[model samples]
Structure formats: C-alpha cells, structure tokens
Target: MARIISLEDVLKDQIKEINQLEMVTSFIQNKEELKDSLIQAQNDIEDLSIGVLGLKKDLEKMKEHNVSQRKLMALYQQLDDRIIHMTNNFPESLTQQLDRQEEKLNPIIKEKTPNSYKKPLAIVTNSDLTKCEPIITGDSIVKDCRKMLFKDPEDSYIIKELSDSEFSKIPKYMIGRQTLSTVNAFITTINQIMKFKYGILALGKVGARKKGELNLYLEFKKEESDLKAANQEGEIYFFNADDYERETNSKLDKTKLNLLTVLRHCKRIHEIRLGKNVKYRVITS
Candidate 1:
C-alpha cells in the first residue's frame, strides 16, 4: 500500500483557509462603520445652517424695534417742549382753562395768523401812542419789509387800521397784553414811537355768558429802538408777505389790501418817509 499523508498536514491546510476568510469579513465591517459616521456628520452640518438663518431673522426684528422706539422718543421730546412753554407764567387753573380752550378751538380756526403784520422797534406807551401817528400805511411797510426781511414774495396783510389814532386810544394799547415787534431793525427804528406802548394785532369775541371780547397786546418802549431790527417781541412786528407767512406759518391767496380800511378816517397823509434811523433787514431763525 502507498504511504498515507500525516494528519497534521491536513489540519494545517484547513486552518489557513479559515483565517483568510475571517480577515476579509473584518475589512467589510470597518468600511460600513466609516460610512455611517460620514452620514451623521452631514446631517449635523445641515442643522447648523438652519440655526444660523433663524438667528439672522431675529436680529433684523430687533433692529426694527429699536428704530421705532427712537421715533417715539423724539415725539415725546416735542411734547415736553410745548408743556414747558405753556407753563411759564400762567396760573394752574387759568393754564388748564387755556389748554382746554385751545384744544377746543384750535381745530376750528384756520391754520394762519393775519396776512399782514408790523414790527415795532419799541412799544409806544399808551400815553405816547395817542400823539403819535403811523404816516405810512402798514400795507406799504408789509411789502417793503417782506422783501427786506424774507427776500422773497409772500401772501399777507398788515393790521394797519389798528395803528390809527382812534384805535390807539383803546385800553389794549394802555395795557401790556398784545404788543408786537418787527422783523426788520430799520423799520423798528423808524417806527420807534410804537415801541413805548402796548398794541393789539388781533381781537375777537370771547366768553360764553358776558360775551366780552378777548384782546392781545404788548408793551413797548421808544428808548429800546436801538435793538437789532430783526429782534422780535410779542406778536406785533413789521412784516411783509414773506414775514407773515414765516411768522404765522400760513399761506395766503392774495396780498390782502384794505388793511387801513379798518381804521377810522383821519386826515389823509400826503407823504410818508421811513427815516435812516431805521434799517430794514432779513430775518433768520
């Protein structure tokens, strides 16, 4: 009989095949683990991008809120200024009444002052206003002063009629309630007599039961005519169309004449001259 192979050699051959197969299976398992890790990383990156976009939107909303808050703050400042101005010299009850009255009437009135105005260098004393006379028509002053003060065309009228001697006799001029100043220094100088007394530029019916009229007036002094032409005191001023528009913040359809018509007839003036003592100037805020 032939010689048989040893059992140890057969056993060694089978073990070698088994070890090779195990190595191949291990390699396949490691590759699958690496692939899973890569997929998880990609998902994390996508989630991070979504979170960043959400944060950007929230930042924009915050910015818009800040802007609105700033605007409201500005409005509050304006209201504060008005309150301070109103409280300056008024009694508490009177102030409250005035506030209520203004609230009720401001809307009904047109958004304009008178179309014309005069600027006084000084308030004429009631005693002196009686002897003094405004030789030139307030209308003329309004036109010239408008050019000198505003350097532009305007729509306005002067309350020239009130400057007449008859009106000066009224108690308003004697009181210090409604005196006004001019926009031009030169005009003030020329009309310095008006500076010594109180004058009214506006008057209207007032009171519910008594129905007495309300008047506005101011005190002026002739000696103070040396002040700058553009310096204004109270509501009265030497104004042109431009000055009226600027001071009152109003618009006019036409240059309203007939300002002097409101005055009682007096000796017709032959000529009027604005002396060099007064100087007209442009008004600036």
Candidate 2:
C-alpha cells in the first residue's frame, strides 16, 4: 500500500492550488489599475486648479466691462433728458417730434455702443508662469551676482570700501546698462532689484565722514533684516551726506585701481602669434 492515493483527494489538492494562483493574479491586476487611477486623479486636480484660476480672471473682466456699459448708458440717457428739458418751452408739436426721435435714437445708440471703449476683447486668457522662462531663475542669477561682487563666494564679505570705478561695475548687474549716473543712484537701484528678485537687501553703500569713510563703502548683507556683524571690527553706520558740506558730500574719487578698468570684462579671449602656423626645417645643431 503506497499511501493509498484517491482520485477525489488528488482533485481536491489541485483545486486548492488553482484557487491560490487565481487570487495572486487578481491582486497584481488590481495593483496596476490602482496606479493608473492615482496618476489620472493627479492630472485632474492640476486641471481643476488651472480652471479655477481662469474663472477668477474672467469674472474680473466681466465686471469691468459691465461697469463700462453702465457708464455709456448713463451718458446717453443724460443727453436725452437734457434735450427734452430744453424743448419743454417749445411748441407741443416740436416736443412730440423730439420724443419720437429719442425713441428711435435709443435703439441705434444701444447697437452702436461698445461694452468697453477699447477694441473688443476676449475673456481673460490663461497665463501659466511655470510654462515659460526656464532660464531667469534664482540659481543662475545668484552665482553671477556673487561672482561679480565678491569674486569668490566663500571669500570674506567685508568689502568695506569701493572707489568710483569699483562702484560703476554694479549698474550692468542691476539694470543691464552702463549709463547710470551718480554712485548714490547705482547702489540704490541694485538694492531695489535685489530686494524684489532675491527678497533681501543685498548691498548698502555708506558715505559718512563724521563716523569714518570719506567715500562709499559697499556693505553686503545676507538678509533684509539686520544681522550681527561678521567680525568685531565691522560696525555698520549711516548719515545724511547732503546736509554735511564736508568730505562726505564730496563725490567718490574716480581713480580706478588698475589698468583693466577700461576693459568690459569679456569671457572669451582671442589672441594669435606669428610663432603659430609656421613651419621651419630644423638645421643640425
């Protein structure tokens, strides 16, 4: 007797294995379906958010146009009323003629009147900022600004003084122009741009002789809010230079530090020598 196998018992074991396999297959199918559903749901949410924003803009435009229509209608009605008032003293026949003309004019006016004074416009168009300007980001500008101002990002931030030539380098970074006049305006503009784009006061120039410097000192801070000085010797101060008729009121010295002041600081270089592209037979030495 070799365990006395029965057909009914063997059939029962096989049925149980088949049921387990079916369950595993169903589970895998459900997992993939769930993933697809999640992706679809995420896309639907983004679409809905964009639609809601578009609806808000359209509402504003509708309101503005409606108000404009009301204004035009009011003006037309006022003119009609004025004409009627003037003709009150005239003959009844003439006044009746004016009334009839007014009735005819009202329909024509309504047809000719524009909802807005400007050209007919469609509803507010969608403008998605993320879809455009992949280049004008903080990551790129910060490095350029840091490199231009400090030369080295990790270097000390204590650039206490800058001559007129040194100060002139800031305008192109701020407004992308080299025609800005006065050192006072240059620093102010650069700080304004930095504040809006970077959300911090990046630089400050102080020209107070009563305290210390006769020229503008380029004080770069990490943030808009006041921060502790990086070192004990570095103390920040301010004064009104216009009232002081002394050295502080005098303009920053235009003396450039080096011969490279006139150079536009281009990145690419072009140079050639007669030594190159020449062939000579070597004589035995």
Candidate 3:
C-alpha cells in the first residue's frame, strides 16, 4: 500500500532534514575548535605555573646563598685576622703560606659570593669617581647619602644622577612623596612597634614631608622590642662599628626587602589612583 505524500509535506520534511544536518555540522565544528582551544589554554597555564614555581625555587636558593655568603665572609675576615696575629707570634713562612691560601681562595669566594656584598666600598659620583672602585662592603649602608656609588667586582653596576630624563631610572622604592604628618605618624608607629634607634633620612625626590629638606630618611632601630623598651629614654644613634657589632651579634634583626619589588607595588597603587605616570613634581618636603 503506497502512502500518498503531498508536495508540501515532502518539501517540509526535506527542509527539516537539511536544517538539522546544518545544525549538527555547525555543532561538531564548534566542538572541535573548543576542544583544541581548551587543550592549548591548559598547556599554556601549566607552562606558566611551572615557570613561576621555578622562579620561586631560584629565589629561595639565592636567599640561602646570600646568607651563606655573609657567614663565609665573616669566617674569611676572622681567618685573615688570625693570620695577622700569627705573624706577630709565628714564623714568616707560615704567614706566607696563609697568604698563598688566601690568594687561592679569592676566585672561589668571588664566584660563589654575590658581588653586591663586597668591601673597600664607596658611592663615588661622576666628579668623585675619577678612579672608580666598586663599593663591595657595608659602606653606603652607613651614609645613606646620595651621589652614592657602590662597586662590586661581581656586578658591574652604574647609577645615573636624577635628571629630568634619567630620573625614571631611579628606583621607585628610592623615591617617596608623603605628607609631613603622615610621615611623622608612620615614624611614631614604627618606633612604638619596633623601638628602633633613630631613623636614617636622605633626600629622595619624593616622600611624605613637612618641608623641602625633610624628604628622605632611613630608620635604624634595635631588632628586639624588649631591648628598645629598656632603652626608651636613651638616644638611638648607631655608628658603623655599632651597626657591625649588632649585625654580627644577631641583635640587628632586619630583612633587606627587595626595593624593586616594593616599587612595583607602589606603582600599581599609583596607577590605580592617578591612571599611570602622571609626571607630577613629587614635593619631597
């Protein structure tokens, strides 16, 4: 028995079949693209995560190496001192042998130790740096002065003066612009919290300041709050020797926060408020 199929019904049926086929084809194509994209994105994210993990591991290693280097430097100094003392008490040949050993150890020490931590250092400016030598030690830490240069044989570093064009090169962490009251409040809070000695102040291009001359300062305080509480009435000023002793004796507990990292964070804040690099004269005072 042949079922009678009208032309209208046949046309409708064909149209429906074609539409369904088109939709299914489109879906299949989209699904393939989506799957490929998902796979690619997953791979990219995994690679980025691995890179971040590697960077973290490297940073940890660097920090450990820095600590070890500091200790090694102390040991080296002690050994040198002992050799000098023995020169007065022991034979000349023994002193010679010690000197030879020290010479042999120099390259290994330089290679293993960070160049930033060296000695006979100074922050020589263009005028002062006629014969520039790297400031390898803790010399600049004492002065906190500008026109500063530090030399380390391990790192070939240069600091340009703050001119209109070169000012950008000055680390963001090095520059601060803050109100005087705000600055004072911060200082008070820090002193109260940590009971550090006097703070060190240098002229940065910007900072929270009351006057023009009050632009820059660094805080040097005792590490232990208990000790600070004990010496509440006493003035807090540290000389180079005092700082050295405090550091060596483990009394000066300070962490050297990476200045660059802080600066990047501040820049983000500035961008949020000011919408990026609005070159305003940072009134330091």
Per-model RMSD to reference: 23.1, 29.7, 25.3
Cα error, residue 46 of model 3, in Å, equals 1.2
Which structure among the candidates has the greatest TM-score? Answer: 1
Provide the TM-score for each candidate, comma-separated: 0.24, 0.22, 0.22
lDDT of each: 0.42, 0.40, 0.43
Residues 52-169 of candidate 3: C-alpha lDDT, one tens digit per residue: 9999999999999999999999999999999999768898888899999998887554233222222445546666544444454655523333333554311221111123433345
lDDT of 2 by residue, 141-187 (tens): 32123222223211221112235665465445442433424333433
Which portions of model 2 miss their true places by more than 4 Å?
1-29, 89-285
Pick by TM-score: 1 or 3, better one: 1
Give the per-residue lDDT digits (tens) of candidate 1, residues 1-285: 998989999899889988988887787868788788889999999999999999999999999999999999999999999899877856889878988999988777544343234343433345534443334675552222323333221112222222434545545433233322321222332233222112232221222112221322211222224333435453323323333333346642322222211121222111111343322222211
What's the distance in Å from true for residue 98, model 2? 16
The order by descending TM-score is 1, 3, 2
